[model samples]
Target: MKIPPHRYPSPLGRCQPEIMDVETTKRDGWQEQHILVVSGDDSRLDFVEREFIRRLGNRLYGGKRHE
Candidate 1:
């Protein structure tokens, strides 16, 4: 769910809305260690992280060495 700058939703409920600013380069993007934020009604960030590990395995997260 990608939101464009010019097309942000107006307002809703008790939650205060503010735009999150981030600087990114094409080479080093989401694959690198960085602060990411999920801005929606659900906790998709947790879901994404879990899915990434599930697909890629523990090495991505540096779990341990199997002997």
Candidate 2:
């Protein structure tokens, strides 16, 4: 599911992609947080970001805590 930099679309309609690195740091040891980095066109970035968040949220909080 990882898209290569060269295959990413550009801001102007062409492929102007780049590299993206993501890292996560925990704070307070109670709440969960995430960090995302993207180096590509902003066109489909929002949708992709939303999907990532949605999927992560579902995985983290969708099920019962004790289950």
Candidate 3:
């Protein structure tokens, strides 16, 4: 079975923010001053711990740029 071009919808008309965000993030690594929004009931213990440590360190020593 083959579908005609007229029957197939073009992807450019689709608007999916989450898909775009993931694609952009993959292309460019995460940056500072950006709000990270996580969803779902999955456990995020490790991420929480790391984020807490980073914030605490920054607060104590000020913002230090790491290459």
Candidate 4:
């Protein structure tokens, strides 16, 4: 199924297109999921985000980057 970019619906903005991602990961026989949204501005889960940071040793990212 394909939705034309022009037909992409965003509940937060003035009809502009936005990108979203649903990620699933498995660890220790359990499945976990997270949704990553990329919009100019929008919503979130503060508590869950904080918990995720805590679980990751308080690091927002654990990868090397080129700057």
- Which of the numbered candidates is closest to the native, going by highest lDDT? 3
lDDT of candidate 1 over 1-67, digit per residue (tens): 9786696665664487565545444224555755343332335457776666455554445555689
Per-residue accuracy of model 4 over 24-46 as CA lDDT, tens digit each: 22232243344343322224446
lDDT over C-alpha atoms for residue 61 of model 1: 51
lDDT of each: 0.52, 0.52, 0.58, 0.47
In candidate 3, where is summed lDDT lowest over 10 consecutive residues?
A: 33-42
- For each of the candidates, the C-alpha root-mean-square deviation to the true structure, in angstroms, is 15.2, 17.4, 11.3, 13.7
Q: Give all TM-scores, in the order shown.
A: 0.19, 0.27, 0.29, 0.19
- For model 4, the superposed segments whose C-alpha errors exceed 4 Å read 1-45, 58-67
lDDT for model 3 comes to 0.58
Which residue pairs clash within candidate 4? none
Candidate number with greatest TM-score: 3
lDDT of 2 by residue, 1-67 (tens): 9886676655786565554432222232224434444333445568777677667766866933674
lDDT of 3 at 4: 59
Q: Which ranking of candidates, highest lDDT first?
A: 3, 2, 1, 4
- Ten-residue region with minimum lDDT total, candidate 2: 21-30
Better of 2 and 4 by TM-score: 2
**Candidate 3 lDDT by residue in tens digits, 1-67:** 9885675766966765544566466335435446453332326557776677667766966786879
lDDT value for model 4: 0.47
List the pairs of residues colliding in candidate 3.
Answer: none
